[model samples]
Target: MKKILYAIIPILAFSIIFLNMFFGHLVFESETQEVINKYSVYVHLLSEWQSESKNIIFDVTNTWYKSDKIRNTNHVFDAESKEYNSNQLHEINGKSYVELKHEFSDCQEEWQPMLYRKAVDTVRHEIEYVQGQQLSTDPSVSVYPDTENENYDNSEQQSKIKNGFVQFFPICTSKDTTSYNFSVKTDNKDLGFDVYFVSSSDQRENFVNSKFDYYTESGCYGQNKQSYSGTCHDIKKDSGLLVIFPDDLKPWTTKVTVNLYENN
Candidate 1:
């Protein structure tokens, strides 16, 4: 009886392990398919000052979630059925300007613009900044209207808003590594910064069954104890650390650590 029981114990344990593995794999595969079915490009609005100074106050506040990186981010915006309108920014003098833009991806390459706005949504695969636009000399400060009134437009009673925001297009890739750097040269001293290269992984075998690149940059935007947020797409990496200095201080430096977050 002892010998029989021992033989049966190994068989029973093996059966349990097999069942768990099989079910887990099936569940993962199902999830992956769903994401692909809903893939589409989305327009994500970002303020240059918010990203640079690290003072991004917005969060998951809007009814819809818009992310350029994540799949099925279209829940944030709708060009069809006219679900929501008037997604624009206000100016200082009470005028309104629509800082509209577009994104291009395999998922949303065919989407067209609507009649309500001047520009329709488009796509650009890489992280390319719109050329010829001016970059703020004072990176520590962000320029935006103090109040939010949705109905106002450009007229005598309208607000005085200017085009100060920069438009960036996110590029998706399977590359193993990516990098960006920043530097400042002053009359009194010269200082430089580096965002070292890091690794990326894709653990979602249940979804696309492919790897996504991860990237990181420290102090690339600005320093003033600000906050910012954006979507990371299929890849994963730390947003980074924030640091601030006094106005009188001349020189400061720090390194950004980057690592990839793969699917598990």
Candidate 2:
């Protein structure tokens, strides 16, 4: 009877050890799979973020290029002649300036004359001073405004008010990256501008109406800037509007570059 009991006790011990080993293996496999699933989700999200960022950059840059081309081809002022070439002043948006002036004359708005005179004078003066010397015939010579000067005249700046030199752009921020960067530069050093990033169209409209009075407590903005570079991280949404407003009534072209990083 004692020998039989000893054999049974050993068999029971062995069985218990075997069961523990099998259960341990199952637990290990489950934990490993969980880790792999998490990793795969991260990789997928990263890929999507990269694709979206590339598309946003391409769209913004393309739009900027088209705008520059249109402005260059359509608007050319001869300061010396003090005239807009009538041939080049073809109907824009299906309405000619000649037609608009005739309509304004008929309406007899009290502000029409002053407004027209200011517009014409501003165009003439800006073109003369901003262009500097006559454009060269050489292909290498650029006709764009020069931005090398680091100093601006305070008197001239004070005399000018912010104008309608505004541009709107769409910006996309990636949740995976959590932030993005931008750089803005103008060819006219005298033409300082403001940059605002807003999460909604309503915010953009508010900014336009308030102009310099508008303020953002949780967004990115650069005010009275000729050239600026910065990063935005407090993004409340995945997409937003980038609004640019010139500080003065000057016709200038600006170049903007946006960047996104995987590790940011």
Which candidate achieves the best lDDT against the true structure?
A: 2
- Give the per-residue lDDT of model 1 (tens digit) for 80-188: 5232222446331122223322222223322221211111111110111133111223321112111222233223111121212111212223333222222211111
TM-score of each: 0.17, 0.34
Q: After superposition, how far is residue 247 of candidate 1 from its true place, in Å?
A: 24
Model 1, residue 91: displacement in angstroms? 2.7
lDDT of 2 by residue, 68-181 (tens): 111122223334332211222222112221211111111111111222332453464455445553132322111223232245543443333232233344443324224434
Q: Model 2, stretches more than 4 Å misplaced?
A: 1-162, 174-177, 211-219, 238-241, 247-264
Candidate 1 TM-score over all chains jointly: 0.17
Off by over 4 Å in 1: 1-30, 33-89, 92-95, 99-217, 220-264
Number of backbone collisions per candidate, in order? 20, 0
